[model samples]
Target: MTSIQEKIIALKHKKNALILAHFYQTMDIQEIADHVGDSFELARRAQTATQPVIVLCGVRFMAESAKILNPTKTVLLPAADAGCAMADMITPEDVKRLRAEHPDAAVMCYVNSSAGVKAECDICCTSSSAVQIAKSLQEQRIIFVPDQNLGAYVASQVPEKEFIFFHGFCPIHHQVKPRDVMEAKNAHPEALVLVHPECTIDVLEMADFVGSTAAILDYVQNSPKNEFIIGTEMGIVERIKQTIPQKSVYLLSTKMVCYDMKKTRIEDVLKCLEQDIHEIDLPEAEMKGAYKSLERMVSVR
Candidate 1:
C-alpha cells in the first residue's frame, strides 16, 4: 500500500495538480506540497502556475482565492469547514453597509475574507503586504475591513493615510494578553521573541521580530539564537521544529492554536486528493470583481 506521502505524489502526477499549502498545514502535507507559504504568497504562486488542478491545503478563503485567480483550474480544499474566524468577522453585507456610510472611501478587504466580501472590495491584502497596498492608494479615506488589529498596525505605520477601522480580530491572538508577554519573557529568559503583526500592539511591541508565517520561519532558520519563543499558532512551532531540527523552539503560550486551521488534517488532504471532493466554486461575475481587487493587491509590490 502507498503511504500518504507516496499517494499524494502519485495523485499530483495523475491530476497534473499543484499543491499550494499554508505554513500551518501538517509537516507531511507541507513536505509533499509543491509550495508552502502564507496566503498571499500561495495565491501568487497559484496564479502563476500552469497546473490545471490547485489543491489548497489551507483555509476556505485561500482555496477560494486560488479558484478566483485561476478560474479555469480546479481548486480543492482538503476540508470545506476549515474556515477563519477573522474572515467570518465581516461579510458582504457588512461591506455594503460600510460603503453606504462612507460613499467615497475605497474598501480594502483582507485576503482572509470570503469571495463575497472580496467581490465588494476595491482591493485585497495579506498581512505582509497590507501596508504597501494601502499606502499605494491615493484615496483620502480607506475602509480596512474585518481585521481591526491589522488595520491598527497598518494605520500606525502609515500615519499619512486615513483608515476606517473594523471591529474584528483573530480570537486566538486576541486572547494573548499583555501579561502573557511578561510571563513568556520571565519563563524564557534566553529565548528571543518573534510575533505576528496580527497580534495586538502590546505583543508586537515586545517582539524581537514581526512578520508573517513564512517570515517567522525565515527569521528562526537564520537567527543566531538557537532558542526562541514563538507567538503565533502551534503549526508555526511545528514548521520551525521540522525545518530547524537543531534549534530549541517554544511557544509563548499554549493558547494560540486556530481550531479552524486544525480542521484540515493529512488524512483529509489525501482523501481530497484522491476523491477531488469539496471543489471550490465562484461565479464569473463575482470572480471578475474579486479578481480586480486581488490583481490590484499583487500589483502593489
Candidate 2:
C-alpha cells in the first residue's frame, strides 16, 4: 500500500472510523470504504454505526443525511464543495410554498434533497424506493420535490396517485438525451440498456431496466446477460469492473460523469481523516424531524 493510504488506514483504526461511500465515488475511495452504496444505503449504514466517527465520501447532502441519522457521531465530509445541483436547487421555503398551494397533498422528498427540506416532508424516498414509497403514502395527491424526472417516473408506475413536481434535476443525468440511448443501443446491439430513473422518461422508455445505482449494480450482478449499457454515473462502471470483472459494462452516455461526486479525491479523504475537516452538523429539531420521513420510508417497505 502507498504510505499515505497506510497512514489513512492506521488513523481509521485509531479513531474507529467508518467510511460511507456513494456508488459515484472514485475507485480508490470506494476501495477503502467500509460501506459503498447510494444515499439511502449510506444513511442506513450511519443509523447502525457503532463507530464514533464517520467519513462520507460523497456529496454534501449525503453527509448531511449521515449526520441526520448519526447525530451523536462525528460526520466529516471529504470535499466541502461537493454539492449536488438538484439538492441545492430547492430549500425549505419551496417546500412551504408547495404545501401552501397544495394544502391537501402530502410531501414526498427524494433523498437527494437537503435535510431541511426533508424536515418539512411527509416522507423521504430514494430512487430505488420512490415508487413503493409514493405508492405506500395514503394521500391521493403528492408533491414530489427536487428531481422532477424521478418523480414523473414514479408517477408513471403508480397511476393511482397524482403528482405535483418541483423543477429540479441532476445536471449530469439531465445531459443524457433519448437519442443518446438509441445511439448506444445501435452501437452495442448485444448489450442490455439499464438506466437510472433520474433520466428523462424518453431515455427511461428505451432502457431495458430502470432503477437506482444499487439496483443497477444488483441487476448486472444477477442478470444472465453478459454485456450491458449502464446509464448512471461513471463511477458505477468502476464498481462494476471491480465486483463483476467477468461482465462487460459500458457507459450509456459519456456525459454521465458527476463532477461533484468526482470532487473528493484520495488526498481529500486522507486530509479529512487527519484534520477532521468539513464536519456535518444539523440542528437537533431538523435532524429528528427529518429522520421521521426517512423512518416512514423504511417502515413502508
Candidate 3:
C-alpha cells in the first residue's frame, strides 16, 4: 500500500468511517474501499453500515442514495461534480406527467436517477435486479424511466407485462454500435460476447450473454470459457483481468469508459476523509419519499 492509502486506512479507522465504492471506480479507490460493489449492493451496504460517517467513491446519485438510506450518518462524496449524464436526462416533473398519462401503470425508476426522481416512482431498481423487480410488481403496465436500453432489456425478459419507456440512455453504453461488436468478434473468434443491458438493443442482441456488471464478473469467473469480450465500462475489464488472470478478457469497445465514474481519484478520497467536505444533503421530504421506493426495491427477493 502507498503512504496515502495507509493514511486513508488510519483516518477511516480513527474517524469510525466506512468507505464504499462502485465497481466502476479506479482500482486504487476500490482497493481502499471497505466494500466494493455495484449500485444495488452498495445501497444495501449503506443501509446496514455500522459507522457514523460514510464515504462514497462513485457519482453524485450514488452518494445521494447512501444519504437516503442512512439519514443520520454523514455521507460524503469524494467528487462532488461527478454526476451521471443519464440521470440528468429525466426530471421529477417528467415522472409526474407520465403518471398522469398512464394512471393504471406503476412507476419504476432506475437507481441511477436522482433522489427526487426516485421519490416520484413506485419502486427503484438496479440493472441486476430490474427483471426481478419488474416481475415482482403487481401492476401489468410499468412506466420505466432513465435508460430506455435497460428498460427494453427488462421488458424482453418479462413478456407478461407492458412497459412504457423514457428516452434516456447511458451516453457511454448507448454510443456502442453493432459494428464495434462485429470487429471485436472478428478479432477474437474464441471469445464469448458478454454485454451489459445498458447497451443499445442492436449491441445487446449480438451478445452471447447480457447482464449487469456484477453478473458479468460472476459469469466470467465461473464459466468454462477461456476468452471473453466485455461490453460494459472499462473498469470491469480491469477487474476481471486482475482477479481472473487465467481468463483472457478483452474490451468490446474502446468508448466504454465512463468519464464521471473515473473522476474520483485516490487523493480525492483522502481529502474527503480529512476535511469531511462534499457531504450529501437532501430535503427530509425527498428522503422520506425516496426511502419508500428504495425500501421496496431491497425487499424484492
TM-score of each: 0.96, 0.98, 0.99
Clashes by residue pair, model 3: none
Superposition TM-score, candidate 1 onto the true structure = 0.96
Q: Could you list the CA RMSD of all candidates, in the order they appear?
A: 1.5, 1.0, 0.6
In the range 3-67, model 2's lDDT, one tens digit per residue, is 77778888999999998899999888887889899887888898889999999999998898888
Maximum-lDDT candidate: 3
Q: Local distance difference test, per candidate?
A: 0.88, 0.91, 0.95
Tens-place lDDT per residue, model 3, 126-244, is: 99999999999999999999899999999999999999999999999999999999999999999999999999998999999999999999999999999999999999899888888
Give the per-residue lDDT digits (tens) of candidate 1, residues 153-259. Answer: 88888899789988989998878987898898899899899988789988888889888888888898998898898989888899888878999888888999888
Better of 2 and 3 by lDDT: 3
